[model samples]
Target chain A: MNGYAGKILRVNLTTGTFTKEPTPADVARDFIGGRGFGIYFLLKEVPKGADPLGPENKLIISSGPISGMMIPGGGKCDWTTKAPLTGGYAGASMGGHFTAEMRYAGLDSIILEGISPKPVYLFIDNDRIELRDASGLWGKATFEVEKQFKEKLGEEYQIATIGPGGENMVSYACINHDYGRQAGRGGVGAVMGSKKVKAIVLHGTKSIPVADMQAYRKAGMALYKACKDAEGLKEWIRYGTTTVVDWCNQVGALPTRNFSAGSFEGAEGIYGKTMREKIVITDKGCFGCPSPCGKYSRSKKYNSYVEGPEYETIGLMGSNLGIDDIEVVAQANLLCDDLGIDTISAGNSIGWAMECYQKGIFTKKDTDGLDLKFGNVEAIFTLIGKIARKEGFGVLLGEGVKRASKKIGQGTEKFAIHVKGMEQSAYATHNATAMLLAYMTCDVGAHHNRSWAITYDLQVGRDLVVPEKVARVIWLQNFRPMFDVIGGCRLQWVELSIDRDLYVPALEAITGIHRSWEDLEKVGDRIWNMTRMFWARENDGFGREWDLPPARFYEDAPTTGATKGQITKLEDVNRLLDMYYEQRGWDSNGLPTLETIENLGLEAVVA
Target chain B: MTASIRLSDSLKNLLGSEGLFTIEAGHSVREAIVSLGINPDLVAVVSVGDEMQSKDYLIQEGDTVRLLAVIGGG
Candidate 1:
């Protein structure tokens, strides 16, 4: 139990009962922890076709061996459940002190199940745990609720809570932690809301036992030292994701005017340089993080503090909506964080609606008299609140762009800009076919984290469709998510050229298990197939049709910028998917073949 | 050739009130920034217009240069 906390905490809100079960060593061996454990539990415990928002659905939160250790960017956690929105696999990664706190509490996973009779919050302080009334906090903003908890229970505890949007079960609701950092995406917070669980207030001081303390400490220190010594480390941190804002703008990757074009004329106002000069009050770090990327900003215009209006928000809320004001983007980010919704999804959905209005698909009456136009900061702000409340026309939008478009059908689905029902993250992949395929094949839909091959696309030809390109994406897909599996940030290795080999020693010392990159990649491959299996089991005809980019990538090329009039041909798109499926040992329909499942030892876990 | 170079707050503090400094490029972009009499650590990225380029990248005439300083991260 050296690598694990040796126990699992199961809380049933409906029965108001809590139980602790010893962590299963066999399960731990098969699925290491964090995202790995989360997926495993989501597969086994949650039945297929179960309603994602019902009492039957359970939220499984777990941390991996590397969490809370001295390892570089060691703090990370996994939020996994059946998605309320997609009704498929949902696994969101959270980074903050909460993961580290789990290790200290001597709990490997916390399984929350059954709907409560009323609003309640789980409070844990070492061995003591209680379900307290959350009556007053039910409708409060995420930040305000967290602040209230910090004050009520002392600042020592770390809390993860949802907002009014979640309480109402908005399809894209997210969980907010440490004021700003979120387990964002896939409606995990909606599941919590439907269960009437408002917050998790946890504090612990017990030292996490390691298999070999000296070796672990040494390996961890080496990683930190290398990251600090990295040539780009200082620079990478200077702006974090925001640093790429100017680069995206230059390279035609910035999503402007709801992805109608690649570059934005007014992008300079929202670039990293401008934010650094105008806002950015302080920098915030996760547990034991050396280079903090959370640009905590104080918007003097709003007289409020928001952790980031990072590149995604900059793209989706700023350039995507034609809003140049940094303060406006920052305020929008703050609103999404407090409302307990995914900022990327919220921003993209709103951007899509704005595009619809601009195209004369809807009139001012259809938008509840708000005009729903780009660059209208006031109107955009109003729509965000209405969506969270599921008020007026906003009720249709809260379901997300995929559903919203179908409801508002005027051939609007052509410009939906989603893959497998999830709104695309900030990157405009109009010409970048590899990145487009990456988004399509990502387990959680169009999220960039699974395989951020944009840099690889730049290094190689952006428009090239080849087996090697598919291989590169597959390799990254297997490799990148291992960071989440181990409960650590990928940036230290991704941004900094620090040797990934450094993590091997840290893993061995922590878990007393010798696992090389080859062994780990196999596990990554297994997890990918297992998640794919979950999708196939849950959704009818979950095949090639589901792994699709929005029609816009093929139909409408950028009318402006570097990628003007350049579209990935439909034949080439199919060819890329073919190569990817073949490389992944899947069939033409993109289903994991029986032979592939057997080879990955996932046959038993699949349908 | 005189090209405008904008310095951030941190770099502004280091390089003084002269926000825009025009310098001649000798060997490479790094050399030009170094020639501007600014600390190397204070400069994180050097850009020509909006394009982010490495220190080894060549800077030419009429390029709107931007020198960003390493501030803080996430």
Candidate 2:
């Protein structure tokens, strides 16, 4: 098939068996690719109520038609599994050259099933795929393991490896790749670690095909031109997502002190400009991306090189922990990356711990004699290491804030700041209803990627719990993730504000499919509804209550900073949910109605 | 007529102002922004005091307007 590697690689680690199957045409045509393929395989193969870390759980990695092509921002890959973190659905989009390599190696998806008898790594050289001994690499840091793989396999190969966090089965452990980028969130790496596969090394020299090669090339070049000519392109490349640090601070959405406040008092020290001036060493890009957002920096204070203290890290680690120093946040970011943990969740869990300590729920005695105070950089660093190793207080924190808060049980769950089991990402949602709903209904938990409607919230009315706000959130939910569905990054349209219509011709030329934004959005809506069904199918008695944002947002107003005395009313929160459920065609309980299911053609997936 | 305008830190250098400043009334926030020689596209969100306002929002007497630069992603 044109624009496809057209093969799915299946490796049964339990029996050391391997097989290759032709990519199913109907699956590709209907679901599109990448995350779509991931969920399709997940729903069909992974039986309901299967243990997430057991042999029944499968890790499916996929790249879409646009992946590895000469298209701008085409480096995204999706890692979908029965999430060990949330125990529902997990689909993490990873950026770098690895997806391209996987495509070139003649793979549309790589499925890892069952548990291995011994530690091993999957080595793929074009069609040569094997499970090699990985005993020596099992416990190593992700960075060290990646370095070892590149050295041993030659630099042409790409590697995705997990560290102690994954090896020890930390719920938020992530897969590290390209020295910096990661398949972060939902503990996909933990699943890989559970299967006793330390890493996947890939090297492929085969050429990727397109239906209309000449049209594809022309369309791709035009895309690059549009991106190059886009306004603020240079500024976007210079700062990446960090560009928003000052903006978020100004708007009181910086997630300071674990969501108690929106603005950080010392936010100036860690703003984008401060970070660029103080620590940023280079601007990095993913494969074929012109507007690169990855800021590679060297922290002189910490004596470390890290990819980011990106906006999320800045808010979660820097400001949320009461840290205003960019260098210290950078070091903490490096600690999480090297240890194979999701910085968003790690920072969040640590922030919760800091709050708990200050609230007297945990004294120094329970904290291993360390003062776990907010802004105590040393304590943050120590706790990260302990969490990665799953030791002491770290073990409890490693469970993520939701479960940890329940275990602590001194009214700490009120401040845990999560939706479902996943900790809330950077944005402080005190009064931003659109963003609050985005987090509340986000399929994979409290992630912001599925729908970032904070800007829309501010542009409309931050506290308005109206149908328009709900509609905006729903539109974004259907629109933003289509990039991942096609194995491309969303920031080109999101950050650059480039003409999204520019992608139409390119997608058509590459895949021979004529899809408008409406058609693509329909697919997005279908994927979203299907994933929501996955959540309902996985959990018993799951309903509207699971969609509620943390009580802190509704109960407590920030007593300081820009959002001082600002809070969303509990009734307004429920009102927003009521509108959102109505707009989404779901019942008040939040389960997809039978008619809604049949309308989306999702009866079979749920069945 | 006059309206108070608040520029974020990133936009302050362009306008040579700190915090809130009153501006001669123009029909709309866009017009007022143009009168100040600032590009409207540079601002991501506009607020009439605490409530959000579109660029086309008519500026009224005693209105305090706030502007934030566009910057966000997942």
Each model's TM-score, in the order given? 0.92, 0.92
Candidate 2's residue-wise lDDT over A305-328, tens digit each? 999978899999999999989999
Tens digit per residue, CA lDDT, model 1, A1-607: 7788788999999999999999899878888998899889888888878899998899999999888888878889999999877778889999989988877887888999999999999988989989999998989999889888888888889999999889999999999999888999889999999999999999888876789999988998998898877645555566777887766776677888888888899988898878977898877889999888889898899998899988888889899999898999999999999998888888889989999999999888899998887899998899889888889977887998999999889999989878878888888888888888988899988888888766556656789998988998899888888888988998777656467899999999999998998899989999998899889888998899988888888889898886789788888889999999999999999988899999988866765
Best by lDDT: 2
For candidate 1, the per-residue lDDT at A322 reads 95
* Predictions: Cα RMSD each: 5.8, 5.9
Please state the error at residue A164 of candidate 1 in Å: 0.5
Candidate 2: which pairs clash? none
Q: In model 2, what lDDT does residue A581 have?
A: 89
Error of 2 at A6 (Å): 0.8
